[model samples]
Structure formats: C-alpha cells, structure tokens
Target: MRRAAYWLFPLIAAAVAIFIVIFMIQINPSAPHMNDGTDGEESDTSPQITEQSGSWLDRFSISEEKGYFYPVNEVSLKLTDGGTATVAAHYRLTVPLKSSYELFCVKEELKKSELPYFMRKEGETMTLFVDSNDQNRLVSLVTKLKTYQIKATVSPYTEEK
Candidate 1:
C-alpha cells in the first residue's frame, strides 16, 4: 500500500500535465512550415498616408504662371441676412500679405470657415477678394486672420472692367 501511495500521486500529476499539454495544442493548433521560396507575407494592408506641405488645389492647374493663385472655385456668396448675393465676384481687394508664409498661417482658418474666395499674388501686393456681399463674412474672416497674427486687410476692392 505504501509503495502504491508514493507512485500514485506522481503518476496522476504526470497524466494531468500530459492532458493539459494535449488540450492546449488541440485548442491552438499550429503547422510548422519551412521557408517556402516566396515573400512570407500572405496579405498586405492599405498604404499609409503622407504629409504634404501646401494645399493640393495648387497642383490642379498646369500653367506657366509666376504668381499662381490657388484654385478659383465659382462660389455664390451667401448673404448674412439669410439671402444669396451674386455681386461678390465683381469686387476685389489687395491684401497686405508679406509672403506665402502669411497665407500658410491663415490656411487653417480658411479651411475651417470655408471662405469662398481665392487670393492672387501680383507684384509685391497680395490681393484678397471677398466672395460674399455680406460685409459680416468679410469682417469675420479678417478678424480670424488677425487672431493668427496674419493681419489681413478688409479693404474695399473694385474691379474696373
């Protein structure tokens, strides 16, 4: 009986350990493979995104322009008093923009507010055309620009046809 008792415990433990290993392998079975003369990747995910410096709209047009303005989208300016105005296109103003760097600083605001005007550079002066007949929109845009220290002008613009 003493001999049986001494061997029984170790025998039971060994059996349990063997069963545990077998169960584990059965649950998560794996197949071993030798290097199959091909790239190990079975599938690939989509590519990563890239960080661009300037607006993508600048690349849309192909022209030999020294002072190329960004994409000029035809926008119908919405009046602040719940109306639409068609007179925005006739007006233009020259912004006191020092460099392209200044426009870059206000880029976020332009995108956030969805200002519907394009700026063109001529000589040493950068021009900003207010796209809306609503004076409030113009004032709001200039105020936001001032917040960014860009100091964009809200001066009146007239286009002589």
Candidate 2:
C-alpha cells in the first residue's frame, strides 16, 4: 500500500491540474478556433497575403501607437495567407550557467515572483526558460537570481584598430 501511494498522489495532482486548465480554456475569450472575426468586428487588420502582393515586407503595417507589440522573453507572430489566419506564440529562454545553482532554489524564486517557467532537465544547467512579457519582471527575475557572479553577455565585439 505504501508503494502504491507514491504513484497515486502524483496522478491525482495531474488530473486536477488538467481539469483546471480545461476550465480556464473554456472561459477564455481568445481560445483556439474562435478568433475568425466572429465578434462582429471587421477583419481589416488581419489581412491575407497573396501572390500578387509581391514582397512580404511591403504588407507590414507598423506604427508607434498601433505597432506590433511583441512580448519580451517571448515570441508571438500573427500571419495571414489567403483565407486563413495563424497565431503562433512560442517561448524560448536561456540563461548561462556560470556557477553551481540549485534547481529547486531557482524554481522557488520564480514562483515567489509569480513568473511562468519550465525546466527541461536538471542536467541541462545552461538552459532556463521563464515565460514573461513584462520587461521589468524579466529584469527583476535576473536581479533576484544574481546570488553569485553571474552575468549575461553576448558575443565579444571586435573593434577596428
């Protein structure tokens, strides 16, 4: 009985989580397959691309007020072609692992800050993906994780002599 309890608890928790997700999805306004201009608004902004359009760059409409607002630490792109509209939002984050840091601590810290994050494997120390759109939140997360001498850097720039 003791051995069975170890597996049973996790299964129950997973089931509850799944149900909650389903419930949230049902109430969500922008759930999948519901954004086909069914809300009585014209779909002018969500125009389609055609072969006659020539270059894709010409179709891009970007402005300061109604500019394409992309989420930080996230990638979301909306593309239209002919009679179909596609929305793709994907998450990709990586933080270099310079020193030893416990996975549990990182997780707890993210949770405390109310950020969405997922860890693939503890063995993969160099990759930590935290889902967030707010720039300040992302900055705060980096600051909180600075328990040691960890610095985010890009490729070294070469200067002309």
Highest TM-score scorer: 1
Model 1 stretches astray by more than 4 angstroms: 1-94, 156-158
Candidate 2 least-lDDT 10 residues? 150-159
Clashes per candidate (backbone, < 3 Å) = 0, 0
- For every candidate in turn, the CA RMSD to the true structure comes to 19.1, 18.9
Q: What lDDT score goes with residue 15 in model 1?
A: 100
Mind giving the per-residue lDDT tens digits that candidate 2 earns over 31-146? 23434466888655423444365453443432223434443475467666678665343333346554455455666776798777654556645556765445556666667667
1-161, model 1: which lDDT tens digit per residue?
Answer: 99999999999999999999999999986754433335766533322321253343443432214333556677476448766755553333235667777777666666786766677778878765555555666778778777767665555556559
